[model samples]
Target: MLVHENLARLLQSYLSAGLRSWVQINVRSTNQFTYSEFTQLLPNPTITLSFKINPLPGICLLEISHNVAFAIVERVFGGPGSDAQPQRELTEIELGIIQRVVRDTFGPMKEAWRNVAEIDPSIEAVETNPVFIQTGGPTEVVAAITLAVEIGEHLGHMTYAYPYSTVEPVLSRLSPQSWLADAKHMSPSEEDSLRRAVQGAPLPLTTLLGKTRIRLGEFLALGVGDLVRLNTRVGSELPVFVGNKLVFHGKPGVVGDRMAVQITRRGT
Candidate 1:
């Protein structure tokens, strides 16, 4: 389910936003299997998408049933009533097309996650093979994408398995700790107020203040009572900013033997 959930999220991001609502993804099961061995286990009529990620077993797989495959192909090639049906058997050309489409869709999703997770984005497509599956009486055709995610440590390394039904559980398990831990992380009013507050805040003045400058000649010319003209003006309320925006204004004051800002005005 974890893999399925990941795939669904990935699919949602890969496909057009308008198409997201029309598609459904489910996780069937998840297990650990070797890339070569997994491919051998696939039924005759299958579609595989292959890509590589170095420093680990450079493979991952996305398998889909025939019904799903037809649906996807129909969508990609336009809609139903189109001439997308394979003649008698699935061809390598058809498999290649499926692979390209899947690769195009998933490549950006992988990159997006990589950026968010701070991982490398060096995966390359190797191949996409289609095979046929049979369960009982010709249930439907199936396709799979076998991707190389990383270089394998061993000659016959095992890869993670995420069949289509376990997406929700996996996503639940990987949900952000802070969000999961806090029941009331943000109230509606608090979130709305924060949005409004950020919108109304004044722009940062740090750049206007400019950088400090001091030359060796000037240093030698320094004397007692010599004033250093700072960008800040005397008696002017100092701005307190975070992330380059004014949050508060105050005058300098002594508090408990420490210099502190005494609030003179509050930022919006």
Candidate 2:
């Protein structure tokens, strides 16, 4: 339960950012089903995404409703999001496009479970019809998480199913302590990586000399060599900026053959 709730929060925020839209997610139901039963559980024409979680024995499954999947596809293609269902199997071209969203369904799992264990989940396959995939034993039980996703005026559901045997070993690790630890501390490697990324980033540096205002006719009638008046004194200090924000003050001067600003003071 803790795992599911945490996953929901991360998934909602991450997906909303990626899709550039408002998205709401909620846990609709939690239950268990036998492997054979689960395979046939979703409606026909559903998009089935399979993933392999490292250190786990079997592949996990994600079932998305036809309406919801189609709505997402339409939204990606610049259409107003639709709740209409798709009546036929997706073609190769459409599948290529939708595959990105399919792969991202479990993209948040690794981060959500990082404190408990560093797990890697890779896409195993995407099946338009569940009947085409070969899965586990008929009697194996799988835990299922049904979630309702709301986008605009449309509401749809997506389900994530994990084999009971595969996740049973790490069930004890999904606790409040793990979540708190993740929130309280950034690992040493993570901190170092963040620092390096900041250090490597490039910032645009520029110096604003002065500003002036003139009438439309005066501007239009100006010649190429004509000098325009500025609102600053000849020897006054000018403001230096880095990516829009004023960072320091400098004096205008010449460096060999080029014009320059010599830094005189820092910005408050």
**Which of the numbered candidates is closest to the native, going by highest TM-score?**
2
Candidate 2 on 94-197: residue-level lDDT in tens?
66666787667556777556556677787887888778855678788999998888866667888988888778887666665654455547687645533443
Error of 2 at 162 (Å): 0.5
The C-alpha stretches of model 1 lying farther than 4 A from their native spots are 1-4, 16-21, 34-37, 55-57, 81-87, 111-268
Residue 218 lDDT, candidate 1, scale 0-100? 99
Specify the poorest-scoring 10-residue window by lDDT in model 1: 149-158
Root-mean-square deviation per candidate: 21.5, 14.2
Give the Cα lDDT of each candidate.
0.43, 0.75
Evaluate residue 206 in candidate 1 and report its C-alpha lDDT on the 0 to 100 scale: 33
Q: Count the backbone clashes (under 3 Å) in each candidate.
A: 45, 0
